[model samples]
Target: MSETAPAASPSAVPLIRCRGLERAYGTASARTVALAGVDLDVVKGERIAMVGPSGSGKSTLLHLIGAMDAPDKGGVVVAGRDLARFDDAAAARFRREEIGFVFQFFNLVPTLSSLDNVALPARLAGKGASEAQAAAQKLLDRVGLGNRAADFPDALSGGQQQRVAVARALVNEPQIVLADEPTGALDRRTGEEILALLGEVVRERGATLLMATHSDAAVSIATRLLSVEDGRITEDRALTPITAPIKEHA
Candidate 1:
């Protein structure tokens, strides 16, 4: 593993910081390095896209930042707290309250209605059922799915389900949102819509967003782009302003 990267400058605290992060899987003979001394810093409200081929560690980095998993070496700091130092309980609390995650598959409970699916996190955090459902409804409205709130995930279209997933991620009003190929399972048009909704919602909330995806449409929506290759960040650059697609008259 490489030496730890220096801490972020004190002038402006980064919302997410990774220092010499490393993770490996399997036995010595079959070891696979998922991350190799990676370093990164993301400011609040920035939309960062991690693009890479399969097995390039984009998801691994996001997982580490989201505190879903611990690194084998080095550390991750989010919202000024070191994730490496968090005890199991602390880690669980941090994930539940401070961070939001959207996965490639809509991980909604099949038995739950869209409103319940979005409200589940808040319920888990101790909010009253009515209050949580109210918040979830507003988020669904924001995602253009207000009419589908009472429907179960099985009854919704893939796009609608993914929109519900986005709503669920925002229910807690977290400081950061992490998405792993959030639009991967959808068609190109649907994926574009999801990306636009994600960008709009995260920007409106003033929350940081870190997404791992291979879609160029997804990359275009990001303010910054990072390319991961062979477990290392090979390119990091600010993207030019992204204009909304032009609409043709009917």
Candidate 2:
């Protein structure tokens, strides 16, 4: 079948689009449905929160859009690149260069220093070691982790580790950032700090954010909210929205 989606007007073109998306696991008798016929379009510069109960398909939708998993019956397109057309290598390249991800677990490499962990994606995208480290250092400084660059994941506090994760996500300068429960591992105070930093940097970079979360802190910065339930999107609405960061005095 052609990967064509129903035509959208030029002005309404989305940076990410999902259509008839369906995903399931297990055999028919014991199958578990994750997403059922989800249709979503995300324009650039919007912060959207995908919220629901733990098993409500939010993460499944994230995984599909992030190229971590595939839909059973439909397709996803991001930045006009059809995810269905991506082979393993293409998907890796796409993920390395086109999108970023921050997970609940602060998935940093245990053995790599904080700087290396953040630099991994840029390096994978074919940067020289110095170039990748330079970019990583800049982001670490942005996330308030410049001093911790040489520390390994084991040496950092939970909040610090998450800061590293955030820096890592932005290292590639991706147009889209997918975060799943990004603050789940941090304490309340730390979570808020990280979320604020995240929102600030993403807004400054003009990148779109799609996060699957249950935290009010995450929702507070969102421009749109999507509530998924029992494998489908049940509600989508606009919120107060995140405006650009206020300029600071010199």
Candidate 3:
């Protein structure tokens, strides 16, 4: 009988781990590979940025880590659960309960007020409406959107809406926050403000953040900077002075 390799030691296990991860679409003649043999480890409370240009698999990697998508090969383990181990239904629940997401487009519902939008996740998690709304209010206030809580998405500027999105992401108190090009749609000044808010909140909560962006300013907020090109990471550097100003925004 053959024996499997022993599991990695506890001290070596990462909060997020991707090993030989790959994602491909279509078959032989039309196969498009988004990722190829990627390996990475994100420790608890670590803030890392994945920087890459269009079609470089940065978003795909983020999705895979967030349990929104599965890998075609290899594995992605998040919060100690491997992506390959979960069925679709389980993965969806895991996403709702364990991962917080902030997208560039700010996916808030048009009909809901900013407060309601942030509270939706808590409601989904089974909190009473009043309790959830109160929690939502606290988060919104922390993000500097307390006065805009009753405003709808259409009434807010891009940055304000994104701040609401950030607040919404924290509603569930997820262990890992995944942001994909969160500042892509905002003006430089507004984007900086949103990024600063995100950094502050993540630090205060001591949650791990893995954000993917093409902006140098975005990379500057990260404690560790990783560069991806041609669907592969070419460099990974830990910035000594992460607080240094990179791009002057606002």
Candidate 4:
């Protein structure tokens, strides 16, 4: 028998691609297929909105794409790296370095000040305390929360806390921002403001944004609108170009 050379691993090209993604929970007899054969291609700097009714799999798709959860079958590729290739440790590092998340609940620690909360991610990534503080300060200022930096989560209003969460999401300067119902916690007025801020940040940083939302107003800023229903994508539409934020009406 002749000896053969080893095959090379897959190339690490930078883009988000999902192949026949399917996810289900619970036993086979009582399984819930949250996602079914979902295929997605998200390139750098693309603004995408995943819109669906409640329980329509929007959040599940976001979590899978963000590497927060894995599909029962199929693979998730981000920045040309297959997520399935990583071990638990590597996956955590990848998420820390490349994925930024904003949740609807604005999960800031109640005891921490806004500045400290925003700076926590960087700190966890081994940044020096002072460096994290400076970066957090700048981010909070960008989000118009500079004056509230010393305030704790309970002291700030819903919108302010969400703004702090936005700052925290950007603290690490991740390549992709995955947001799940980021505007859901706020009233219409405040939600519009946060959406506008998100639009501005996405444009300014040239970062890819994939948001899961049901609100029509949330989809207004998206460059592409994707509708998922019955565990499949039913529509993908490119809307009018979005350059400026739609003003919020009180």
Candidate 5:
């Protein structure tokens, strides 16, 4: 697979920024730290893959960046707006307009057709049904799922459902896409396909991508790799063209 170019110089304004971020769960007796003083900066158009063992703060960091969850300390700033400053309504608006998310479980509405599931985000943002459906159709085609648009989630294979999820993530033309273990549920071959599609579409749309995964094949496509452990980033480095070989599932 071809590698994406590096992002702009360090002087350029970062699209995502996290500063002294800290997150924890439970009470004092049973407290568990998810993130501890984690900081990061991502420029526009960067494909960043975060890899780590289970419960290593990868999901926590992604949540903070996506504003799905707030940090107990510090702040996350995306496109110049401090996430910590958003009120409930503003946060909702920001999520709808500025950020897109993909999850391990396809998370499609079981009752909605693939096209409708893709179009739902735009529709909820007050877009006309016709306009949203049109956009969703175009995305479905881009993901090679145009013919499956009318099928419900239960009717499609796992790979097909994931493709729909990807289309849904891009329907709103978000500036940032946060994926939490997006390929975790698939077999290796399907996972590679999903990762490749994500890299291609995200690059084509000029959207920054931050993906959390355990698969090295997934990391191979990233422009930068970050490894987190014990609630902190242990490695942050750029990947060369020959980062890692893509392996097939047995």
Candidate 6:
């Protein structure tokens, strides 16, 4: 959140920019402030871990970046598009075409097979059935779930379901991925596995990853750490580069 923070690279343009972002809940008299004057610049391909205590606006900021919620004050500019100017339909289109989302609970359709669940986003993005299936299959294979493509969410293990969720997020070939506590529901070892896969896929696609998490395992994959406190960024620092590749966890 500093103008003096070392730049991402020679490209001074940020893929995402949040200026004075503010969001709150409830009526003003009893309102809860979620974000207050947060300013951040995210360059392309940067992996950012947003860490904060509960109720500190970590999720609120992620929602704003992904167009899941509107900011009460200030604005967000993503890929040169001003989010405040987007209508409901436009926002939906943007999310479908440009941003991928991974959640803690997986959120796959209960009745859909793994392949179908993974292909859902691509279908919504207007890809044909065969194309969507192919993309979904590739992602599933990448996550080591290709053989389980026909299985439904309820039939899969927690780690497998999350792998499917990760595949679903990437099916559209989105440039940005927004994950909200993606491994919060998994055990420690499982969480580590999921994070490793998430990091690998994002890197493979050259996509930016913005995750809100409390887990140190989640933080390990990030190139930068952002600490949020009381609705504002309290710290932003670079992480040491990982010389060794993250081991395959599954």
Query: Best by TM-score, which number?
Result: 6
Give the per-residue Cα lDDT of candidate 5 at 30.
100
Residue 35 displacement (Å), model 3 = 0.4
What lDDT tens digits, residue by residue, belong to model 5 across residues 1-250? 3355344584789988899999999999999999988989899988999999999999999988887899999999999999988998999999999988999999999999999999999999999999999999999999989999899999999989999999999999999999999999999889988898888888889999999998888666788999999899998887753334333343
My TM-score estimates for the predictions, one after another, are 0.93, 0.92, 0.91, 0.92, 0.93, 0.96
- Given candidate 4, what's the lDDT at residue 20? 95
List candidate 3 segments past 4 Å from native.
Answer: 1-12, 241-250
lDDT of 2 by residue, 1-250 (tens): 4445433344878999899999999999999999889999998988998899989999999999999999999999998999999999999888888788999999999999999999999988889999999999999999888999999999999989999998999999999999999988887777877777788888889999999888887777788889999999999877886565533221
Cα lDDT computed for each candidate against the true fold: 0.88, 0.89, 0.85, 0.85, 0.90, 0.92
lDDT of 1 by residue, 38-150 (tens): 99888887898999999999988988998889899989988889998888898889999998899998899999999999999999999999999999999999888999988
lDDT of 3 by residue, 1-44 (tens): 33542233447558898998899878999999899878988887
Tens digit of lDDT per residue, candidate 6, span 41-152?
Answer: 9999899998999989999999999999999899999999999999999999999999999999999999999999999999988899999999999999999999999999
Q: Lowest lDDT 10-mer window, candidate 6?
A: 241-250
What is the C-alpha lDDT profile of model 4 across 134-230, one tens digit per residue?
9999999999999998999999899999899999989999999999999998988898889888877877888889999867776667778899997
Model 1 TM: 0.93
The best candidate by lDDT is: 6
Give candidates' CA RMSD values in order: 4.1, 4.8, 5.2, 7.3, 4.3, 2.0
Clashing pairs in 6: none
**Judged by lDDT against the true structure, how good is candidate 4?**
0.85
Task: Please give the lDDT score at residue 165 for candidate 2.
Answer: 93
Q: Rank the candidates by TM-score, best first.
A: 6, 5, 1, 2, 4, 3
